[model samples]
Target: MVAARITVNGKETPISPAAPHTTVLDFLRERGLTGTKEGCAEGECGACSILVARPGVNKPTDWVAVNACLVPVAALDGQEVVTSEGLATAGEPGKPSTLHPVQEEMAVRGGSQCGYCTPGFVCSMAAEYYRPDRCAHADADGHTDAEHGPNGFDLHALSGNLCRCTGYRPIRDAAFAVGTPTEEDPLARRREQAPPAPAATEYTQDDSAFVRKSTLEETLRLLRERPDAVVVAGS
Candidate 1:
């Protein structure tokens, strides 16, 4: 009875009006979230990175960075997403919002240039920042390497993001400079709780339908009924 929806930056939005094939990037952009760029429609460019909460190995939820251009809006029914604009904490009326640790480091360290890829880089870096094992692994190793920072930041976390004008030194500096999340950090505290459970959705508009069954048995039954249905994994 209820329409399919997604929670973006803590706001619940209905996923209708947009077509079933609309990418997450387009959906967000249509709502004035211009930070998610589309450098390449293909997933090769990391210009459309966004944070997604998913099951984690060490913590209850992990802030996972994913390419928005590659995922359909319909596939994220009942999911929660955080764009670059959502990273900052809102200030009191008329006051400027406080930046997240990753954004602060990036600004102070000159990590942005032209500002196209900066948001994507920030999202990816934030994902690594919230990684539960990052600090523990660094402490265990007790030594920094070319690919890992002294603070346990693995440079590989940013391998997908690319910059054309700004050199990587500043970006690397920013990534290495971010400190651990404080106890008061809401995003950090979210790790203690479970990520949102997947929702079974059946959304239709303009004669096109998108469905997500609650169980494998129902899915298999639907597949048998509709032989033309295409399966999409991890959409």
Candidate 2:
């Protein structure tokens, strides 16, 4: 068995003796964060899209959408993850204090139905909203991260969420409709666009080149040889 640590929402937890093949959806659902839903289970469908923020080697931080159902639980070690459950600000459960601007705008714009897909869309939008510099690029993609990137908006950011009820037009509208942060709520503004940390840490190892080890001894030897290396010894 292997041990791993990760921050869920904003808290850190350890996954020791974790099964080698556990998917992220299984881990979150098992841990009681059911806000993250699953529809197609494959990466093609954005139903399981969740924003994963991991310490980066080159960039400020790497946050992207991932198909939780297909993603292995072991991949989440030492990262900051935010789910639909993390949408609300720091307050009463489900309170709207720091309600992600996307969620707030979505609520006013009638972007949700049945509510199952709301969380996924919330998570995706939160990632887009949180990154200040992303708006310019997201804007170029036709979905710009700008508070007012597009009026009708594009399905590029939310392509991961599949909503059969709203037909996506209203949802897109709501996403683009989110206005600039106002002084009415300072917390809301903080959540929408957070400043980056002054210091950058080497929070993750490049798993793209890592090959699985067949035995514990081999894994130990590998780690000893390359102390800074990221090795996926086992599940």
Candidate 3:
């Protein structure tokens, strides 16, 4: 059988050699994508946030932020993930990469928390930045409030993340200051296309195994065949 693979930061990588029980956090960090941190393994801190392309309501695909600490790497067998590092655009050979709008605003407004939390905050903010409906409505006066910003940024997009050293005032300033994505922004353009369909995967290592059927009927058939199977949704 072909090996299960994952697309991370525009690169296709094999998911093998990793234990079936490895969390996406460990999987990513093992490959030196260390921006995803593990503050609370239980998914409370949002420090391990990463973006995944998923079916969308307003557009074909939505950049959804998910917790990496809880999900198994095998769960994302054929999905694409965008880490904090993936948000930057590569510049000329020696030049610094261009920062994503969220990262740019956070840096300019002093919203960066400690090294551990900054990437997570940036990723979650980026998801909101690309929301198709984020700027669709305009209040007559562009009034800013506690929960909503003049730029149409919703504070709830970041509610999952936690920070101790950096209070939210500066972070809110960053979120409120970002502008709509330009016509040339790649991630913004990505919203126009459909997200990748789930791949049929069967991965096993040691005594552990993971399986992803391509259709509902196939899944049901498998359930009948193995009543002891555990089911997980959304990978």
Per-residue accuracy of model 1 over 1-235 as CA lDDT, tens digit each: 5798999998999998999888999999999999999988888779999999899899999999999999989898888899999999999999999999999999999999888999999999999999998873355557567888878899999998889885699999998888999999988998999998888888888978888899999999999999998887875
> Please, what are the lDDT tens digits per residue for candidate 3 over residues 1-235?
6688899999999999898879999999999999999998999999999999999999999999999998999988888899999999999998999998899999998997565788999999999999999863346675566888878899999999998786689999999889999999988898899988877889998887888887889999999998998887654
Winning model by lDDT? 1
In candidate 2, how many Å is residue 122 off?
A: 1.4
TM-score of each model, in listed order: 0.95, 0.66, 0.93
lDDT per residue (tens digit) for residues 1-235 in model 2: 3336667776887754446456788788889999888777776656666777644333445455667888666556555566777756677777646666788888888888887777787777665554434432344456544334554333466766778676576677777766544456432343443323322112223333333354668768877887887544222
Q: What is the Å distance of residue 37 in model 2 from its true position?
A: 0.7
Q: Whole-model Cα lDDT per candidate?
A: 0.91, 0.62, 0.90
TM-score preference between candidates 1 and 3, better one? 1
What 10-residue stretch in candidate 3 is worst by lDDT?
Answer: 136-145
Error of 1 at 150 (Å): 0.8
Off by over 4 Å in 1: 136-143
Best candidate (score: TM-score): 1
The true-versus-predicted C-alpha distance at residue 113 of model 2, in Å, is: 0.8
The model with the greater TM-score, 1 or 2, is 1
